[model samples]
Target: MSIERERPRILFATDFSPWAAQAEAYALCLASTWRASLTAVNVLEFQPGMNPEYEVNRLFLAELMKGATQELADLKSRVAARGISLHTRIATGIPSEEILGAARAEDSDLIVVGTKGKTGLAHVLLGSTAERVIRTAPCPVLAVRAEPSDQAGKDSHPCAGVGLHRVLVPVDFSDCSLEALEYAALLAQRSGSSLSLLHVLEPVSYGLDFTLSLERKRGEMRERLTQRLAGFVEALAGAKITADSHVRGGLPADSILDSARTLPADVIVMGTHGRRGLSHALSGSVTEAVLRQSRCPVLTVRSPKFAAGHRRVIPVS
Candidate 1:
């Protein structure tokens, strides 16, 4: 398909699992809301030892392709019933690699995927497709987490109930976070969603004396953080966006999650440093933690101007 670059484009990768289907519904909601061009991609990946060249393997691969194509067609008809036009593509290779390639080929502004919402060493060690894509995607990536079993099939069409009442963002006065804040503003403008800014203060406690001092200064620190948070959202206010700021002292991931649940945000927009190798594994990412545990979907923006793995992108807040 000859896509026009002038219009915003969204790429959604679906493996046809129930979670991926949830992401599909979420992507459709965003595409319809933004009036952006939408493309759905699915990858047929095989084991390292498996090759399609053998006659038997070729026959099996052909069947899988047929099934995948039919699935995409079914998706088209379902989405089209809602009067939405969708473009679908199929690829053969590693799921994450093919998804990224499609995003680059299409010059997509956003890439959406579904995640199992698991975290810790095992998750990274296992190499999750959504995690890999978020770590290195060429553009913004929205990960819609797997719903709880009781809530899994509740909303086949999430658009009906998922209103954009509030968009929560964590600010740390860093360039990447500021960039994410700008993106949040754009989303708020598009969906008529209000903005909620949270700044988490990592307290330093050495001993009993230090603990007392830190407690005494918390109020003052919160005052200053509130001011800076307000400054960051000034542009948002100018855009005529409704915004509120909050500052808390604790672990960033815990604080952000608490605010998300209490505020009941529809989506969380945050910036990731896109750390890799030693730095990625060592530097404990605040964004990754939130992405894995938050009840709402997370939109992670990695600044393209920065070399993803070269510079130490400090995740602010």
Candidate 2:
């Protein structure tokens, strides 16, 4: 999966919201840098028979599409002015479904979407369109939050003037994490960036009586982790990508976030379990949490072995 070998096709999904606006900046920057074709997608979610107020829904959808179309046109023109070829798409269906459909139709190398960073009840009710896209998109998904506070290397737009200088990847030694590391290395090589592989050791809570035993156990584990990290870096020997490793103690998400801030990472590339339904709700997702809170954009790739089910084909009405 050498993204540099071929011309990349990037799909940018926007709802014309402020969050999506922020994402547009990233889309432009990436497209311009990679010399990739850029497609801007806006979906009109009009479920006809799902509601009793059909007339009201129809009127509202009409207005929504009208506005969305105008906005997309303006976006296309703006992107074109930046010297990147821009294509516009309007589909009527679920946003995630339509966005994924567009990605497939375009054979996109990456799908960029904006997340509102919703949590708690709002996340449950509204759901995360970005997360759904991440779970299902055939290609890697880059999630940009509406607003990120840590704008270390960012220009007026968070992603502006940045070219993935330093990429931080969290590795748990899982197959998924390994795949993410490979992807990150490729990205770093292409962008002339360095890679930082991070592993977080979750502390075991033991009674005071076991303090000595815990200290010895922690030492052994750290030594083992150090050896494993060395092996992982060795595997990328021929890649010619500069890389380093860090083993830290704390929660996985917290540790990853801290590393990103400390490294001042331009981007975070990590793998997701791609869990859904009850499992996802119960276990929660560290990747999703990092995506929600990370100041930098997070690119999530699912393991190839993780069957992404069938590619859903949403009909455009």
Worst 10 residues of 2 by lDDT: 308-317
Most accurate candidate by lDDT:
1
> Candidate 1 on 96-175: residue-level lDDT in tens?
98999999998888899999887667786775888889888988899988563445324546364455679999988888
Q: Give the top-scoring candidate (TM-score).
A: 1
What are the per-residue Cα lDDT tens digits for candidate 2 across 199-301? Answer: 9999887876887777998999999998788766665555676778889999999999999999778889998879988999888899988987887889999
Task: Kindly report which residue stretches of model 2 are placed more than 4 angstroms away from their true locations once superposed.
Answer: 1-5, 48-58, 148-163, 207-213, 234-237, 303-317
Local error of candidate 1 at 253, Å? 0.7
lDDT of each: 0.80, 0.78
Q: For model 1, which pairs clash?
A: none
